[model samples]
Target: MLVGDHLGRVETEALLEMGRLDGALMYCMGAPESIYAGLALRQTLIGALRQEGHAFTETRFQAWFAGLTTLSDDPSHKARPPRAVCEAILTELTHSAWPVLARTAASLISALLAPHDLQSPDAAVELHTVNAHARAMVDALGAAALTPLPALDALHHAVAQSTVFAAVERAEPALKLVRADMRSDPHQAPRWAVEMLYGSCLQSAGALHHPIPLVGLIRPDTAGDMEPGEARIIRAATLCEIMSTQLAMLAHASRQSKRAGALDTRSTSRAPDVLALLSGFGAMRSAQIERVLKATRLGVRGMVQLLLTAGEIEQTTVSGAHLYAVRTHPSDRLGITAPLEEAFSDDAMDEYDASMAQIDRLLNNAASLQR
Candidate 1:
């Protein structure tokens, strides 16, 4: 099927008529953002049609709900990072400045959900309207260094409306099955798979108008790049990102789910496997990783950064060649690897000091020459 035009309103109505709301919602969930915007507007009209407190069974709503969530995985539409963004986040998440970052994130969310002055150059209020929760979220996020948070939060709030929430809540168990699959075999995930699956979960939560749930089962202490505690937090963020996609998909697929040949993918969640593969190989030639993951060189580099920051893996330069290795060793050992010093490793600390000293000498020499 073509990306956007493959589904339309007439087709969506037919799906609803035929009791294919799940599939329809699935298609909507996967549709493009531009299409989703129209769908959301239409949904606003539809919501006006039905009486307050009216509800339908899960099966009755799934197809229509799916249409809304189809593209919930895209980066511009949600706070959830694309694979590349994930790597960047992973790096910052572990940095000494994480507390600052976390506060920033909280501030953005709060700005979206509550009233606050944004630290913009113009000091523009985050949202134009006091009740424009979606726009507020966007404004708040736009003020921050990270750009995706606003649209993502908007998409999330959109999906949390009543009709969408019903469909996902009804199918909670099925969604949980998908979650279980990811935890059970993270190795099956391809490079972008985790983002996709997490998107699905987040959209489902939004459809239910519920706060994103914790992926407590996917603990890092058991097996993965992140530690148990970090994994939970990362997993939660990942879910938020993916749900943004699901929200978009719901609008896009609102029409396509009733049709037999629409809304198909290799799997619902493949992130775990992707992470596993990258982690297992430590560092391969950039080309090697690219070929295996079928991602761009830039994407692989981002992935490497994520692994590095999570302390799951590391890199070194030997004779002008950079190499990667999993940090299967203790954290104490890995601590020595950074530019920062580790008390136990005299060699790394000395090397780092020497490098800094050389830089200092070069700067002094340059200054003297200038004088």
Candidate 2:
């Protein structure tokens, strides 16, 4: 039972083609609604508080809202909000002598719940009962001179774990969506698509200042599902392109150092090219290094061990494979750094931004539905 079937078949297919079905499903899982509710509640509460002659800056409101919603973390990332932050925000909200804010928050929660369709009349009665309990808790907090943290925490959890929230969560996709940390996983289709798109952008721009049109790659016609081998190949090609660019930068730095007499020509001449390769390519397995340099396994292993002992390189395991990369040093000649952003044409960036806005609108519309 694809959730997209209930939302819109064509829209779901479009998300799937873009390799963003997981993202779309997750978005529909009440995140947009939660964000919208939090923002609207904050605005309403602030207005009520101001009418009561309470003083607070927008910055303070932003901080409090961020703490409450866990938006202080990277909002672009899809991770759940931290419990500690939520608890702290609740503690503050409940303990303060701000009855207006508490009442407004309770009203917003009830209003937000009204849109969700329940299973039956009994379910609807149960939802109303939950809302009544929530309102009672807020009233108690407002009446008290100081509400305890535990009480606030309990109230926060009750609302979060309510039947309405569960219903919304159940509507989202069950697939675990890929994140930035999962970029190294060659099996993830989204990662491959992103890497390929980035590589294409790099090749086209020849520099790294302009914005990359990542949305341009999410075409329904072009973005058919990627096979595992295809993903691997794409990952390799992207890594190779990045390494090649890093090597050029290293060479440029080496030339500069040599001209400045900071680097000895004799010493560099005696240094194996493998050092440059490792420094340029970043973390790589022995087989990968050997293949890239066309060197013997034993020779590469010995070089890697020697570099490890010299503190010029380090090894770490990722996804059950040992990988090696150059270590940072004060005296290191090559100051190679990865290009953080891809350069894109102005027209392409504008188009990408528009496409992203359209996608957001679709996702938001889908999220607002109870069915």
Candidate 3:
């Protein structure tokens, strides 16, 4: 079922043996349109090739995989490399490529999916979910590489994270395929394959992310005759790789949320204009403020608390929830200064103010004495 099974074994062995992973990949991609044949020959070819110490180098493997994705065959095209090949390629990248492949794949996949997700929700949701898991796995792997010496547990943890997330994402396309089939003919439903696909996805997710053995998620009823364990393992790995890079983005969001909260505690803590935020929303609940300002619950509460203490905002219970509102609009108070200004009571502030005042008084006293 490979793209070019018509090529004799001599061609296959020669190209694969000569560090021509792309050529071999091309041949595999062009083989007869049969899943079983394509998958079997690919496993044999990849395994035999790798065993000969001609594994696709990290840089080359990534380029080849990225190119194939653009070849854009029918989604159901069975001749293309199975998801397993992608997973193996990722594993190779993580192990041999190190920082380069991990970073490249992470950036590339995110860039590719960003537009697709925006344009299509169904596809985007699945892609994002998979990305989350894959990013987690890759980070875990990358973290392991920094160790004094690479250890099995570290690698295993990394690989496991990758596999689980990959499985989740790969399931997205498979799920779409299944639903399309079921919709076309509910009676002729490819129940077994459909169930197995989802089961496999869930199983990998459980093993990689959660403590659950995901085997229970395996669906026993699909006619597609999918091998649940093997399928789940492969899918999981793919999802893990995509998600690995995304983990950084997730961390970034958390940090931004924290910063927003700090600003809320004291408007002076903010790098951006706090007056703009206050003007935009005259009054808001803590939760709403957090959402609008991208701050965490703690951050919002802290900011509101500071405002309350400074008499800048008054808090009132409304419908069993706390609300914060500006005590005086900045525009209205622009022409007037508050009659009462709270002074800092901290020893540091006191010392600083005292020093400045003493300097001013000395200058005044010197002028008077001279006069």
Candidate 4:
């Protein structure tokens, strides 16, 4: 299917069709700046759709929502590091910065929802709308940095003294305006941005790729590369991420309780084929893996990431062809011998290989989005 064309075939169409200026676009103090940012994000998305084929930009939203979270450690890992530098991080729903984040995210949502400004930028108002909420959040965060406040009272002081964020009437007039957006990419597509608007203005991510729920579930490829987070917060983010994908699948596929050839790989019956093939069959090419799954190239792009992320899959190239094998073979570990090629039918991928162009495209798209 053509790139964007594939989107219309899935449930995501339900959300894209819903991207209207709903009442969610409130007249907050920071709304204009947010709309400006949202327009920039939309344009960046358009470019990715044109070039990358598919994008799950939500996974790489560290920049847009960076300062909003901090890290903690996972208690289960006995060999865990010190309290200051940990693997785990916080999410929007889980962050104590929620008091400020709620307002800031709402401001961003209002910005994303609007293709234009609700009122003229130059128009006079009671409180001037500058880049207020986020700035307020930052200043407020610093002030409340040392003092511990009660749950309810914290929000009262989360905003700058001059920041005014009150309810906006639906009757307010809006005008379409355009601003120059220098750069836009998939990373700019914040995890929560799509999730917050999902089911209404946006669909679940991964129409042309593996569906990653809007959980902002990201970690470094190696050990030292880190983003801010403590242990416990990161754990919460992880739980939320995978569960988001699973729950979304369940909701969309309530009619078919069992995972099958569904759009989302994690929700599909064939999802296990990647692991099964690598584990049972040993080192093989992507074409061979696809043949075993009996699915199109797209569908076969399944649980490889899940396995690889778990450090269970070993990927390397042989004679310029990519080959995958289960790392730390289970059969060898158990002292049981695994049968060779004879166990399967006559499919020798000796001449066949797979290109990681799709994965490369995703990575490039993600890197660009970080701005």
Q: Please write out the lDDT profile of model 2 over residues 193-252, one tens digit for every residue.
A: 121123223322222221111212211121225553343333333333334433334233
Report the number of the highest-TM-score candidate. 2
lDDT (C-alpha) at residue 317 in model 1: 56
Q: How does model 2 score by TM-score?
A: 0.24
lDDT of candidate model 1 versus the reference: 0.30
TM-scores vs. true structure, each candidate = 0.17, 0.24, 0.19, 0.19
Best by lDDT: 2
Instruction: Write model 4 residue lDDT over 274-301, tens digit each, in one string.
Output: 5433332235555655554556766555
Q: After superposition, how far is residue 112 of candidate 1 from its true place, in Å?
A: 49
Among residues 3 or more apart in sequence or in different chains, the pairs in candidate 2 whose N, CA or C atoms overlap within 3 Å are none
lDDT of 3 at 230: 40
Residue-wise C-alpha lDDT for candidate 1, range 1-371, written one tens digit per residue: 43222222222222222222222232222222222332232232122112112233322222122221211222122112122222222222222122332332222221111112123222122111211342233234334433122333333333334231111212234455466435331111111112112222323333222111112112122233444333333433543433343333333222221221221223432222233332322234444445545677787776666556655555655335445544443322212222222111366445545644654575457446755
Instruction: Tell me how far candidate 1 lies from the true structure as C-alpha RMSD in angstroms.
Output: 26.6
Indicate the worst ten consecutive residues by lDDT in candidate 4.
80-89
Worst 10 residues of 2 by lDDT: 186-195
Off by over 4 Å in 2: 1-195, 198-272, 315-323, 330-371
What TM-score does candidate 4 reach?
Answer: 0.19
